[model samples]
Target: MTYKGNSIFKGKFFVWLALIILAVVPLFSGLYWQGILVLVCYYAYAAIAWNFICGYAGTMSLGHSVYMGIGGYISTIILETKGVSPWIGMIVGAAVAMCLGVIISYPTFRLKGPYFTLSSIAIVELLGTFISNTESLGPVPIKGGSGWSLSQTGNQAVMFEFSSKLSYFYIAFALMVIGLFVTYRMSESKLGYYLVAIRSDDDAAKSLGINVTKYKLIAMAISCFMISIAGTFYAQYFRYIGPDRIFSYDLSVQVALIALIGGQGTVMGPIIGAIILVPLSEMLSAKFAGQMSGLNLFLYGVVMMLVVYFMPHGFGEHVVSILQKAEEKIFGRIKRKAKD
Candidate 1:
């Protein structure tokens, strides 16, 4: 097969297979388990989205929850008052998030390393505080510090409201698949290479005449749009939105954690991280529901420290390396046996 054909067979087929399994497996899962699957997809999607800018472009945003909160508020407010379908709200929310991304990129993109990270955190705190203090934007009353909630839209698929968790599961799964596909495609494209070059050394990339700022902004825009979509989905699924919940520092940490723990900069890292961490977090939450609340956080710290100490490159990279070695060893044995 040609290189293109080989790539398609190797990458696209597995993505489809994974999506199919996600879709089918939930049908057999109990209610609680199905919820976990949906949560995994949600966090995984956000992590992948964040990784586009942080991992590939090396922007290292620590305040991505800004976009998530904006998307949620935009979609929920429109759905609640205007009675518009969330299908449309998703697009609008994403557009707004993209604009904020572009706006922030101008100033934040100029800073690098910890400076950039601090700027991002500042933006999130500023936005959160502003939203909480503002009571009204023109005629529409802002939810402000109280947060907002969405009323039932009669389980209409067009409205993005569903009576069944299965429907939400499918939507979340599809979003996850889409995030993976986009990440994979971008990773193989020229833009992806440019992002990598910039990340490795912006001075060298600029010396080569590459527009580093432009590509980083592009990455930021795409990442913002993607995570914003997830935010809209979260609002629609849970039927509520709170600045604290959506715009919290914890949310931003979770997004970063998912990608970092699994293997940042790789397509499968965030997915792997989400698959393991989300479920474990949930289980810990369940176990400590009425008792020890901080134990899970402590355990997560320990796990993260161990991964950093042992597998500094991230778990996804380590796993991939191991699999390749095992495959090579098995193939070598097969060839030797045939020769004998």
Candidate 2:
């Protein structure tokens, strides 16, 4: 029993130790790898937001890209036309996203299983198509299919413009840390319990006097708000935003896949997924280039298949198990050495 307790402690300790190591990686890495790490942070942040509703509430939304697109477009447009700081625009975009998310989620809560998932996909399609054809919303240029590129206002910290890759890395890393912290907090909250209850069996929870729709809506709003912030980060880091890319079904799918593959209901699942898949993706795309364009997708599919079959609960579940074994081996050796 003592050993089991210590093993849990060891696992959690090392997991965070790994995070500490990730923080310093940008210092030694070149601009290219730093860029990749930034992307990993982006996906990780986005995945955590997605997991809140889909993983915890079992909503299975695939339309998250809409909020991201909205966030990026809003911030970029504001900065371009009004000279507003992206810092301020981020809050504005997140507010818009939350409102939209709640409005969209209200009716969708009536859906079930695949119907809900399909409706979400439809929403993304509808929004993306609308934005693509819209050149202007009144006086503001929607840019239509052309997208927005934000000009740098020097390396101004207040403006959210950075002259170095390390600046973006710091911002991305900070966001990821905040995300992880929030997820950990949620896991211990009453809201988390309600969400888990809703996920397990909404009908039963509703019968027990829980306002199922209300809680789900709350989760949806929170998810949208969080994801939209990441979208702001996305536009800021990349210096560009496009409906075709940000609102792409592929982006939504990848974000969901990361959380699901890592372990949907687990807080660490998305981080683990991003860490494993993003680097693998970068490597595969680089190695294959023109000839094997789809190799990454092929491998991703294989990984998804394996994870579903072997770790249906998610790879997050196995992390502790792996650590426990390592603890036993190391501690046993230490004891033997002391005895000898």
Candidate 3:
């Protein structure tokens, strides 16, 4: 087969192998590890979403968590109050997130680089304040200085709760699969080419007759929608939601970090990044979080700085390069042996 044909076959085989391994993981791993894997899948989805905008379109957003928070809250509220199933709630949440993405993109897409990023930060902060202060919708009902419950009470499953970590693990795994498929498809399509063009040179893209605003908005909408689906999975898995946890700046930063460390813009970069960092950070937090508090986070930051300084293209790209080189060496040796 030609090199391109062989590459395609290898890609398909790898994807199939990954799916098979994921299918069997729950049967062997313990509950604690299962829960950790679930978190990994969730972060993997979030990283892919972030990559669509930041890595592909070259638009860095510091407040992407706003969509995740919105999606979680919307789905939770709908499922709890309206007796809607979480499956349906996921769609509704994603739609709402897409609308918000469009709204934000309209004004901010005109700005360049850091200015756009700053706008995202400002918008998230503004929304966080608004949500926290709004008495009717706030997570807590305030009585003077104290506060009461903000979430509805009911059976856990109806509200997307489960007693077993296994349930959450499967849900998260499925979500990661969906997110990966969407990203892969987008990266191979015409829209993906347009996004690359815009990322490389916006003015040149526009001069070439590409609709810059339209494509950017499309990318943002798709990115938000996918991330919102992740949010729905999060609410269902955790069975609780709060502005501080869901809408925090740290969540957005984590998303960007995973993408950057994995090889942003490449199909497998975000997934590789998430797989590497999430587990490492989780393990560190589990071991040292109680004793040292912020130590794990500090270490994470240091590791990120090192990765940025050394392997700026990310581990995925590096891995691919190494594999290609090894293949060339093996093929050359085979040719020499044949001559002998």
lDDT of 1 by residue, 187-290 (tens): 88888889889988999999999999998888899999999999999999888888887987778978887888887777877887888788898888887897
User: Which is the leading candidate under lDDT?
Assistant: 2
Off by over 4 Å in 3: 1-12, 137-159, 322-340
State the TM-score for model 2: 0.93
Could you give candidate 3's per-residue lDDT for residues 234-284 as a string of tens digits? 777766666776777878888888887877787777777777787787888
Worst 10 residues of 3 by lDDT: 141-150
Q: Write down the TM-score for model 3.
A: 0.87
lDDT by residue (176-226, candidate 2, tens digit) is 888877876776677788888999999999998999999889888988999
Q: Which sequence of candidate numbers ranks them by TM-score, best first?
A: 2, 1, 3
lDDT of each: 0.84, 0.86, 0.77
Q: What TM-score would each prediction reach against the true structure?
A: 0.91, 0.93, 0.87
- For model 1, how many clashes? 0
Selected candidate, larger TM-score, 2 vs 3: 2
Q: Candidate 2 clashing pairs?
A: none
Itemize residue pairs with steric clashes in candidate 1: none
Q: Can you give the lDDT of residue 149 in candidate 2?
A: 83
**Full ranking by lDDT:** 2, 1, 3
